[model samples]
Target: MKLAGLKSVEGAHDESAWAAAWVPETDTRPSLLLTGSLDETVRLWRPDDLELERTSTGHCLGVVWVAAHPSGVIAASSSLDSFVRVFDVDTNATIATLEAPPSEVWKLQFNPKGTTLAVAGGGSASVNLWDTSTWQLIATLQIPRPEGPKHSDKSGNKKFVLSLAWSPDGKRLACGSMDGTISIFDVARAKFLHHLEGHFMPVRSLAYSPIEPRLLFSGSDDAHIHMYDVEGKTLAGAMSGHASWVLSVDVAPDGAAVASGSSDRTVRLWDLGMRAAVQTMSSHTDQVWAVAFRPSGGSSRGGRLASVSDDKSISLYDYS
Candidate 1:
């Protein structure tokens, strides 16, 4: 798949578009792209043409993260206010609202089975697992504090979790923290399993290869993307090219190429084996916050890539 710039709506929102994901097809509509922005709104875009379908409002602070249920009927968005709003993707109705006191929410993901939703709880230093049907807090997987003297603002770098991912099996949950640590948790036991360490800056986004449950990819403020062996707990590979912070990373469905969005205002396509960027699209004038490869299982023509930027624009690319 390759990118063919189709349409870009400048000033699509009032602020940065922080997150983007594809909502699978339904009976009436093919499939829609969902995006969350710093403007405190979540927008729905029709692919290929990149037409705006709907704009959702309710968030009080910047919307930092979003996730779609596997069934495509529901999706969730989290903001700086530490609250998560789950809603109906097609109807735009509220499904549930989740929150944890004093602990902000950053990133969220629904299990592959759509039975649960995992939220990255910032200050709480844990992943909150909620039952999808009842929307009740099912488990809190907290990352254990390291063996150190004391943790305070001086060490704010350590315990703050920023991003989260769930293994395809839904048995393992991985969370990235402020101090550049990624923790894996055993969902069944609700216990912290281990930590993956390498990046020294905040790990802002994480994704698991659709084919390899043990392989996890992370984008960090350090301006690099690291591939990790989640089960083995080792750094598999590190890919760097972006001149600024790497805001988001996503793997193509075929598992051969990965795409990243960066503060350098470009979207890069990296070849997995060569561990180098093969293509760079500098179409956006501002920092690109999110770049997502359209997931398979729909009427999507060719491979599609969607990117949202600080310039308040969304660009759709055709990945051949």
Candidate 2:
């Protein structure tokens, strides 16, 4: 597989774009792109041509993450101020505003069945699950504080959750944190299962392979991406090349490769089988914050990869 630049939007946002997600195709429209930025707005874009469709604003601080529900009709955008705003993807109408105060929100994902939403609760040291139908708090999967003196040494502070991903079947959940620990949980039971360890710096992103439910990938401030066997709790492999923190990672819809954005101002595509970066795209002049692959199944044919960067730009690429 290979990637060819399809289009690039310079100044896509007024500030750094921190997150990106694909909204699946609906009866009326093809798949679209959703992006959140430090500019405090969430923008929707048309693919291939990378055209700006609409910009939604109401966020109080920098938008950190954006998650699209499975139905393609609804999406949630969370900012640094700890508020999650769920809105209609097409009409841009407000659906619900959620907050778990005393617990800051970072990354978010909607379960495969669209029954629940999982959010990385920073500093609370837990994953907050919300009922999608009622928009109510369902459960908090708390990570147990580490044993010994470090617990009192404010180690929980170091355990601040950063990113999250759901297994393809939606039976399991995994979250990465500030202290470099990856916590896996059973979704049905809402129970903490185990932790995957290796990287020493904050794990900023995580993605589970769509084809291999047990194969999980993570990107970290250490500038390396590690693949893990979530069920076996083993570090399967590590891929490195970026010069700075690896800010985001996403597995291709085909599950043949993984894509990553980094503080190093580049986007790298890694061949999973080879366990190395096979392609690098340095189109952005500043730190690349997020990279995402369009979910397969739409009028949109072929694979498309989107990257947003601190340079206030967004780029779309054709992946084959």
- Model 1 spans with C-alpha error above 4 angstroms: 147-157
Per-residue lDDT of candidate 1, residues 1-320 (tens digit): 45677778888888988889999887778888999998999999887777889998877889998888877888999998778999998778998988767556878999989998988878877778899989999888878765434334465546788888888898988898888778888898998888888887888888899888889999999999999998888999999999999989999888888999999999999988899998999889999999998888766667888899989899888876
Per-residue alpha-carbon lDDT of candidate 2 for residues 61-132, written as tens digits (9 for 90 to 100): 999999998889999998988899999998889999998674588999999999999988888888889999
Best by TM-score: 2
Candidate 2, which ten residues in sequence have the lowest lDDT sum?
A: 146-155
- Overall local distance difference test of candidate 2: 0.91
For model 2, the superposed segments whose C-alpha errors exceed 4 Å read 146-155
- Give Cα-based local distance difference scores for all models: 0.87, 0.91
The number of the candidate with the highest lDDT is 2
